[model samples]
Target: MQETLTRLTFPLSTTSAPCSEEEFVARFNQRPGKEARMGYDCPLCRNKEFVLRVENGFHRPYACRCVTIRQNLTRLRNRGLLELYERCTFENYHVTEEWQRGARDCALSFQKSPLDGWFFISGPSGCGKTHLCTAIASQLILSGHDVQIHRWVEWAAQAKAAVTDSGAYAALVQPLKDCEVLYLDDFLKVQHGTRPTAADIRLAFEVLDTRYNTPDKPVLLSSELSLRQIAALDEALAGRIAERSRNHAVQIGSAPGRNYRFK
Candidate 1:
């Protein structure tokens, strides 16, 4: 295994442009014919002695193209994108309303140059806020960064469970505090006609405060409430999010027609 690993040669970084599922399969599926194997060599395994070994009479294959491909795939999957593996990309997102178009542009810009800082997308329900945030998160993950996509309600549930066990809550939410990119979806998504309770606000404050104090971890946040509404809910927390967002923030809907869920 050590010899195989030492003989492997492939770009570990993921910088290639994103490809469609069909394109990806086609690119990797084109294998050389078996009859042409005499002079052929594996790009990653080098077709050398390290490519195979005999382990107690059993012929074991070591380094190969398949292993290299698996290693690359494992890195991408390790980004913690369980719920967002598909349909969470810039190409998958569609812009219908004027605000959604602007939001799409802003999301693409952030994907291209993420160092611009925290990106906040706020609006009414079904306004493509989550879609935009997911698109950005997908880009970051593909670019080889550790990213966490936390749902606000799910996280609040953890906070509820943590009322007695502080350690449990910390274990659940610590990834949000330290990931390379954190996408907090449906921020403060409380029931309709009711605002978040004091406990809810406190939970949000803790997470946002941790990220705010520890700089450079770009946050991609989306909510059914506008920035002003978030500020009205909790001034200090909103202030921290706003300060980091700066010009990168993109707000969507204001009134009823902006809701795109029905469409």
Candidate 2:
């Protein structure tokens, strides 16, 4: 895909023709048929203006940056995150404790270089874990990467409902493995002192193992359980999650004013 984009963009980069922003717009405002088909409002160029230029005596097309943003927005909307799109942003995430501030900074860093690895955020309910997770997801989306956010229990319920039909189950959970970035919000909400059932382990293993095996696909998790608690759920499943998320693990609770829900 990068190769394809490079091929398409090479011609535009080769020559210096547009003297100014106005000239660029005046000369190349023609939108591509493909862009029109996508139904975006000139996001690729970062501006509504697109360019079709005769550079080096060859006609070349360029997409607007707005198109890229719109594409990212579409990915979020497709994955049921569109509602959270506006509410979850770095600027909106409140930080009342030192740890919360640190966590927010870490999320910002992830936004800058998300390809580093996955993130595992553990905290009590209302500690703003979901807010932080969604903020990171939102930033990544704006950066033009595909992202999917799902509450773990809800996803599991949906997956389990398809148990009678093998094809339905596969269709339901396959995206958890395939998306470029996945945010498993409220992960593993099992009752305390009761170990996760075998069925739970099986489902968790399938999703976690697939994402862990694919190094490029980073998974973000926000859970109430600590890493130790998660390991207790199922050693094998938690091991898979831990191995990939080791460096990026963040614990944010027990500090003064850690919970942001009231704030």
Instruction: Compare the candidates by lDDT and give the number of the best one.
Output: 2
Weakest lDDT window of 10 consecutive positions for candidate 1: 31-40
Can you write out model 1's per-residue Cα lDDT over 138-194, one digit (the tens) per residue?
666645466676788887877777878878877887877877788888999987778
**RMSD for each of the candidates:** 11.1, 5.9
Residue pairs in clash, model 1: none
- Flag regions of model 1 displaced more than 4 Å: 1-84, 255-263
lDDT of model number 2: 0.71
lDDT of 2 by residue, 84-130 (tens): 87797889887656777778877776667787778888887777889
C-alpha TM-scores of all predictions: 0.67, 0.74
Residue 1, candidate 2: C-alpha displacement in angstroms: 13
**So what's the TM-score on candidate 2?**
0.74
Give the top-scoring candidate (TM-score).
Answer: 2
